[model samples]
Target: MHSTRPFLRDLSDSRRKGWEDGLRDGYAEGYFRGQAKVIVERTKTSFPVRKIKVLYVSSGKGFPYSPIDEAIVETLKTLTASVITAETKEPIQKLAEKNRPDLVLALDGMDRPVEQIDAVRALGIKTAIWLTDDPYYTDMTKKIAPHYDYVFTLERNCIEVYRGLGCRNVYYLPFAAYVSHYRPTLTRSAINRKISFIGSAYWNRVEFLRPIIGGLMEKGLKINGLWWDRLPEYKQYPGGIEIGKWMGPIETSEVYSGTKIVINLHRSPFDETVNNNTAKIGALSPNPRTFEISASGTLQLVDSREDLSSFYKPGVEIETFSNSDELMEKVNYYLSHEKERQQIALRALERTFRDHTYNHRLNQLFGYIFK
Candidate 1:
């Protein structure tokens, strides 16, 4: 009655600003404090004087569309005192001899020539190769793995395989997410979809998705990602969104966050019909998307894998489906029950931050190597 609406509006605006400012200040303070702690630790341990010099050989040029390769290089830079990246175009022998790095880390050795690895190893520098595609590159990888000081595989079972290939220092280092890059920070008014799946349209995926896409659309599911350019059917998925172009890791994370459930479908690396050389390794491991989606605090509906239970408690931290029927049933059930879905997502986020991160893997590697 006394025209108090203006006062209420002003109060609301001030409150909004206060919350935003608080979040900004808090983030800045935490970041600096973390840096300060690291510096103090380094000084106490004399780590800077004895800093680990690392040479990171990246596969970015070979896999330009995927951001994970670049992310790995950036993460290594943070973990080491000095990191020199040797791209495919660079002269590896000269760079390694000049830098004389304490360690050389190569990601996916198939993209790199064996001669380059041999050249770097010739400088008496320790070399390690982290293979993302295990048995898929089994033939090529086994040929080059023995040249490295350490052989790290994403598939746990492949440790024996590498050892069988005569690599003595083989280790199991699975794919992980960078927590700082992936988090549930973004907020939205309304969810654009009840479920979502983002990935390239491999022949297996296209075949599996054809019948279910329409049903999923009826239930408000969205699908968007790079599909095979040659397949006109993938170009025009009925009712499903076609991203057309490649999306970076950040964009993928945003899409994961906006959905109620993010589906995790592993691609067949050996589908010869598609002319894709990815081998059907029958590897029992989860890919980077598993950790990335969980770290984003989104409920994930993943396919059943043997190693999944070791990482997360099925029906608790994640939901798994063995077939399309199971997937559809869970999707419908989870959509109707919001609390269960959110709880699983929360548990997964906690697990990811605690165990599944790039920092954790790097620390383990360095500790084992330097010990």
Candidate 2:
């Protein structure tokens, strides 16, 4: 009877453990199903006029935190889209299936792996890939071009490249600023001698600026950015120049307003020829810095590109330079001719207000999508 009692107790414990495990599994399954039902129900509602549900996938690298996330969300709100962001491809696909959004926007060049492309495509949703960087070095176009409904490139040369690659739909959408965020303040004050450039250090930019440092210094230019740290100790020059670490988007815009002239130099790694389909020598692409600096109502001296004339009337809206000599000359000319500099800045502001807002881009995007 004693032995039988021990065996009976063991059997009872095993049965109790099995029942608890079953309960836990049932709870998990129920929770997932409930969550999925909510997502599906939310997606089923009728979208108001001009409202598109956009699923934007980002690697969540630089601006994944709350502040940046909030800004991106706010920008998307202007489009009246229910914006959802995900970091991984699997979750994004799952969301895409559950939500069945009208459109999917991928932030970087390559947001999904090759394996998941079929899953996303299977959803029968329109996919747009936003290329922030040059696509030449990456296999984004080669691997995923066939799956995308449309490809929007910041580089103009990419239109032809993607078309050649059998992407029937390709558009050249240059980088733009949120006009509401980056705009001229009503009060204009005297300019101090602060000059800044904001971007990561790249080999091409470092090499290009090396020979021109002396010219810039001779003209009393105060240069700042990440390039200072990358310079050799012996070659590095010191003086009134201020070097800044990475600045957030808001801080960067504030810096633009405080400075007298903001110089925008494209890094070699991102230059048009390297990543664009245009002939290496003839390739021209304007980075977002052009629009951001101009929108802030700050005087800008940008590296000259042939395509820039298409966007803004050269010598009227903004000034450009080809080499170090040309850059220094423009810097001096603009500084001495303050009225002309202000005029160009104002023209840039006007042009951007009329044609280059994110709203404008969204309109164009939707037009193409519906067409």
Candidate 3:
């Protein structure tokens, strides 16, 4: 009898790799991907989504981008024969071989399986990478993106940068809200209300918040992020700065819902301490949190960006703050005028849920791929 052990062990090797991946990426992260695959496989029918088999490769090593990866996976599951793995690197080839997906859409090129990308594409798998951190990490993305058949950047400024680097099918695809998770929530938590900001204290942010720190504190501000020590006033307000604490999707959405105004300050691209954009391609697009904050039914007071208006209508659906004084002035006005703030938040929520979501973003991606 020909021993079938070789084939079975080969299959088991893949599962064993999953176990190793689970150890690296915690149990819940592993369960989320594995269980979702199981549930989708058991279903007798799938939605008329793209009608293509896709293998999703995620680079969310955990923190901020993890939820984004999960949202993308949930949307991909609606398609036919979707396989997911956070294992990244070497496993991509083995999984691609087993799954035989028509397209391999990798989220965030920073941590993609660069060496094996050519091999996967050689197997006739159409490769695409939707770059989450653009312009900022161009030093790295510029190298990784050329490996893909299609390149999607969150920053419009990088479209030309990639196109110039010889990536043929470059597209400007900004991040969208994971609507199901980021939708409006009831304000039932111990979170502070007047004003809030959720992101790292990048040197640029540290300096930007310097002038308005006192005013923000007076207005009952609470920040949930890391590296606040960069701010000279870190120890001045114990309750105001949450140094080194990271918030997940659920808690972040809750904070946004509870807060009257959530500040969306972007990290400076030219800051060498934090970014690898040696070429210093300017950033023009809003961050992923812009849609998430609006979808959470909170007034997003984002910093000015050239491409911000294209996605969000400022002063109506959203608000823009150019400098610290302007941001402080708006914060004071919005805090006092509850009706105006609520109206803007509601309008932004309607706009975000209507036009900006992972589903909408994916549809655009598929259109470009098929076209």
What would the per-residue lDDT of candidate 2 be over residues 1-371, giving only the tens digit for each residue? Answer: 35445554666777867766777745743443343234323322122246678777664545423333344456666665488776653566788898888887766635467455557778798788766665444444556666687888777766777788788898888767775566654433233444566675566666766776766666655555555666553244576345555666666666676565788887653455446423342347887788878776667888887688878887888888888778777887886775677667766766776677666666677778876
lDDT of 3 by residue, 238-291 (tens): 988889988888888888877879999998999998789899889889988899
Best of the two (1, 2) by TM-score: 1
Error of 1 at 209 (Å): 2.7
Task: State candidate 1's TM-score.
Answer: 0.80
- lDDT (0-100) at residue 135 of candidate 1? 56
- Which parts of model 1 are misplaced by more than 4 Å? 1-50, 62-66, 189-191, 228-239, 274-280
Clashing pairs in 1: 269-278, 269-279, 270-278, 270-279, 270-280
lDDT of 3: 0.81
After superposing candidate 2, which stretches have Cα over 4 Å from the reference?
Answer: 1-49, 63-72, 87-90, 109-111, 188-191, 218-220, 233-236, 239-244, 269-282
Best first by TM-score, ranked: 3, 1, 2
RMSD list, candidates in order: 7.6, 22.8, 17.4
What TM-score fits each model? 0.80, 0.75, 0.84
- Residues 180-227, candidate 1: write the lDDT tens digits: 566654434134567888887777777776667667777877777675
What lDDT does each candidate get? 0.74, 0.65, 0.81
In candidate 2 the C-alpha lDDT for residue 39 amounts to: 31
